[model samples]
Target: MTRRRVLETAAFGAAALAGSRPAGAAQAPNVVFIMADDLGYADVAAYGRPDLATPHIDRIAARGIRFTQAYANSAVCSATRTALITGRYQYRLPVGLEEPVTTRFAGGLPAEHPTLPGLLRQAGYRTALVGKWHLGSVQDYGPLQRGYDAFWGFRGGTIDYFSHRGTDGKPDLWDGDLRIEEVGYATHLLGERAVRTIAASVKAGRPFFLSLHFNAPHWPWETPDDEAESRRIAGSNLRHFDGGTQATYRRIVAEMDTQIGRVLDALEANGVAEDTIVVFTSDNGGERFSDTWPFTGRKTELLEGGLRIPAIVAWPRRLKAGAISAQPMITMDWLPTLLSAAGAAPDPAYPSDGIDLLPILTGQAPERPRTFFWRYRANDQAAMRDGDLKYLKIRGETFLFDVVADPLERANLKARRPDDYARLRAAWDTWNATMLPERPDSFSETYTGGQLADHFGAGGAPTPPRPALAGEAPR
Candidate 1:
């Protein structure tokens, strides 16, 4: 559709929606979107971790549906978050193309862009974000400027769990644009704030959309007991790749799960458990000390492990409990799904790249096939999934796998299934043509000496960084 026609349709829809009350505004389900950063597909006990206990996370699975084929929009946090908020492919916007946005990145989600929270707010829902707003800087682009009515979080990718400082040695904690200092572990602090938001929303008798994005099991590898480790890494980088152990990772995940339990408890305490819609998932794949067993490769790779995530949804009022679904879904699907449940819709001017999965999720429809595409400039990597078949290309090698049968991606069937392989490859090319082209100067996560060796093999050479594409300034 033409841009002008789309905008005109959007204007008409907005006017019509404004004049009418939401289908069930008085009893609209309160949405609690809880996301964990860099959590592996099997990190929680519910998914299949053997060494850790995630009773709270497991509880969520038991209370609702668990999706085995869920995926993040990107292999990185910021990119996936952009898709989540905008309900579109991350590549559609310059800001989403950052791979993972950094403080040096020059753009963010445009304030004028239609966002999940913004649309929900217009539908008579109170919106708040309690943790991790890495979309952009607080100075120019922030949660308040975008969609969130109340924001209490940091504007960085990862922060010191105890000190709440960014890797740049700057205090990154905030209370709605104002930087603030709070003495506590970042995970616990965010959880506490989220509970408070829930309480406030309940008291006000308004349906709320709380985005509880947590930076857990992501980096710095510090639990509340690791304050000394936090102090040790204070002046240095928060990536503390040299630190962290399986036990430490366990503790971090455990703490996050505990905090989630608290948030769930608050819902029950406020007598809204059955009416609230709670979604628990991850931003991307896991990092070091993460167990993504059965799926080879980790974050940044286009492998199944990097893209697949654990997704659980609980809304006792509308969804059946303890259901398991094999339906393939991506991060962008959430916006349209939640909006449908709330009696709202995406802006017609920017139609969602995702479909409303509410019908399928609520058992109103059967499982269906889906097509997805992905690309990462670092290794010249690209991937496409069409049903059970996946076509992957990294460096200069091509591979075809039935990911449904070989979750480990150990078997390549390109030679045997040439036709299917060629079809998927062609489909990827067609889809890529529709999205924004990759800018040569765009920044992607890179590794140094030892890190390069860890990622590649010993004596491996790193791909040199490139400047921006011709005539295109870095976003």
Candidate 2:
């Protein structure tokens, strides 16, 4: 047998041995990681958004834990995804910032980095990725090289949901290496693929690790139906609405939620619901929509609105039902948490920035010590959240806010808390010194005049408006 086959067989043997233990003994739970692209904290029903309903996503929180202060490492797709996969700050790698849709950056999650899937796969889980895979298009960075056994998705950040075409005007859908044109809404198709992958893994008698990354509510706002769009478009004045794009965004999110329910149903039908862990979160914060009200700024900005997002972890058998945690966790934490939960050790060579969150989730651990930092090179925005205090710098304008007291960041205390600001600045500087200079490909000079307008769209608007999904902004 080949080396890979040998490893696979050995992993199966180990799983079988573990399975022979007494019934109800703790076993590695099947992990279903569902990440929505550009979803906001207030966009779901449980988060307090009454305008839109997200019964499926809210159900995860109803059955599990809902985190109030979870954040994405960055405000954009590629950066946050890198942090999620490697359990390290994105700045530690080349091309850590968000990339344009057309350009293929050389920097991707290095093979040597211990990704969540890689660590889980080593511990006998069958891994598959459905939907977006923005890590990299280079052979070494593809899902297959990064420990996923199967990949069915696009490599770009956002694609035309209906046509499966990328922002660069090319067909971006792929099944493994071969490009495949899939008919139907992208969100629904992704869910279908996820269910199929989960069912197949169960049939093969192996625990599964499925990363269902849906690119809904991201851009090119198109939905499964027109009524959903009409409802959202009726009140919005964003230019994208000129072509009934708001309807598309609304329908896309509704469809995404529906499809999510389908995946949950599949898990229940397969008898894995009790033993499976379903994690629902977003790649970054919301954009263009008024959904992220009370929190300032949108995606691409280093503000609470762009960083703070919804995070739900549902493991009915292992966690207390209907619990909520205020622990300040970030996307990077998933790697260590998943590995620890699966009884797998993180690779020693690739030390992780994230700590095991199992303790926090299980009510064993009380808090995290480390501060969270984010730097988006393109926009020259940086933020550091330490304890209850947060310091942000945008284009050299510094501001400090006691996030605990001012969750909305409306109160700037930089003048009153000079010492605190200095300390946070020092901490940020220390962290920044450790990271390599932004990769050449990752750096972009400021756009001037009309060039900027043309790139972002006329009048600096996002190419497509944000989705009016469920959830409420921080009060």
Candidate models: Cα lDDT each = 0.85, 0.75
Error of 1 at 58 (Å): 1.1
In model 1, the runs with Cα more than 4 Å from the true position are 1-26, 447-449, 452-454, 458-475
lDDT of 1 at 241: 65
Residue 121 in candidate 2 has what lDDT? 74
lDDT of 1 at 398: 93
Which residues of candidate 2, in runs, are more than 4 Å off?
A: 1-26, 98-102, 138-140, 226-247, 368-370, 443-475
Residue pairs of candidate 1 with colliding backbone atoms: 441-467, 441-468
Clashes of each: 2, 8
| Model 2: lowest-lDDT 10 consecutive positions | 466-475
Error of 1 at 299 (Å): 0.7
Candidate 2: pairs in clash: 42-471, 42-472, 43-470, 43-471, 44-470, 44-471, 223-248, 229-247
lDDT winner among the candidates? Answer: 1
Tens-place lDDT per residue, model 1, 57-152, is 888889999999999999888999999999999999988888777656767998789999989877767789999888888878888778777899
